[model samples]
Target: MNNPSLISGTTFNEIFAIMEASFPVSEIRTFSGQRALLDNPNYQLFTEKDTEGKTLAFLAAWEFPELRFIEHLAVNPDIRGGGIGNKLMSSYIHRSDKPLLLEVEPPDGELEQRRIGFYERLGFQLNPYSYVQPPLRAGQADLPLRIMTYPQAVTLKEFQRFRDILYTEVYRITVPSSR
Candidate 1:
């Protein structure tokens, strides 16, 4: 397989089709909601390409001066067990100079455990605090979100500030009813 390429809305609709095919509807909805906010100038899309130059994986993030909040990361389910996801993440970590932050579903099952473990292998540490992510739709249940911090030593206060900004800016636009 080949490495993925990083792209923006210039090719996002096509990329989203791959995401929709691989992930659950709820996950897709959440991703679409989040992507809408990051579509502005301050955000970036990092995509991985295969040997044939086809998109294999993608990671999207919002770039602030001091931090990069990974909003969505996905690898096609057909190629899940391969190193495609790892490569995509490693590429971002290598290219980014700022601390990275992201959220993950709580480790509730084998799948979630594996997902968390994958991030851990990439040097992400789970913050002890918990949060309720705003819902993807009105009257929908809020998600139980866990924070993962890259660069290990990032303070809890820093993470909390990031979370606060995310809820206020991203969540408000994506899921206004939850506010």
Candidate 2:
């Protein structure tokens, strides 16, 4: 049976492979920039493993005293349709004592809708706030990002505060200045 586990240095390579397969290289920078946030006292990585002990899925998050921000999540393509993703999310939510939050792409098309549906199925609700995330690259266009909260309902003002904190603390720390 597949089981979820907390990822550590021993499983870093396997976790990176799952992330690379699930997201574009540029969008998966967290795998490379994780060190910068390690000292933040809130970063955590959770991974799911198969019976053979191979990492199959991962969820990274930052936990504040009163909130948890899901930073990244991915399931190995080879095991996508199985329950790994859902299991990983359930594990995190179960462990979180405070409200859980995440950012997702706006429902611009079928893909976005499906993505939103996945989170919704896991008990997350969309926060009625609009936000534009900083561009992935300097020349890339800024994308519309939406906030989703689990368990607790969030107000537009609260969502905006979360976005601003993410932009100033997480984004600034990980993104390098364009030369």
Candidate 3:
């Protein structure tokens, strides 16, 4: 996993490919927008590559002083289920003791439930808050998602503070407070 250094050239292209194949358009940014994120000091892209140096999985995250927000994490669709995601996440978890947080779709269906379960297995608590994720780009509506935190569950105040930080930093946009 490359840290502090930015991913560029073919590696960047390959990572973007996996990102597009793994995530929905509404949940992701455009190629240009995604590429531009590397310029942000707080953002980091961690990839787990195979022996041939091909990107097999990647975790995109923002590291704030008190919070580590995992924006996106996806394994190579073709080679998933081999425990790479778990290793990657576990490694990231051990990298720091700062409180970790991430967003996931509400468990309304089987796949979503499975995802939440996976995180739960890793000691993440799915917080039941009225969370509406700000759009990653223009022309997209706010997405209703749930927050998952490691180590412990968050109180309403903590959730609100995290939300504000995410909006102000990750999304780079602000909205009226969600009561």
Clashing pairs in 3: none
Q: Model 1 over residues 1-179: C-alpha lDDT tens digits? A: 22223355545665686778765555545556645654476667777777665777777677777677887788876788788789888878887778888888888899888988999999998887877777656567777778888978456678767777777655654434433
lDDT of each: 0.72, 0.74, 0.90
Alpha carbon lDDT at 55, candidate 1: 72
How do the candidates rank by TM-score, highest first? 3, 2, 1
TM-score for each predicted model, relative to the true structure: 0.79, 0.82, 0.96
The TM-score, computed over Cα atoms with residue i paired to residue i, of candidate 3 is: 0.96
All-Cα superposition RMSD per candidate: 4.3, 4.7, 1.4
Superposed Cα RMSD, model 1 = 4.3
List where candidate 1 sits over 4 angstroms from the true fold: 1-10, 30-38, 173-179
Q: What is candidate 3's lDDT per residue for 1-179, written digit by digit as tens?
A: 77636586788898899999998998999999998899899999999999998989999999999899999999989999999999889989889999999999999999999999999999999999989888887988999999999989999999989988898999887647663
lDDT of 3: 0.90
CA shift at 59, candidate 3, in angstroms?
A: 0.5
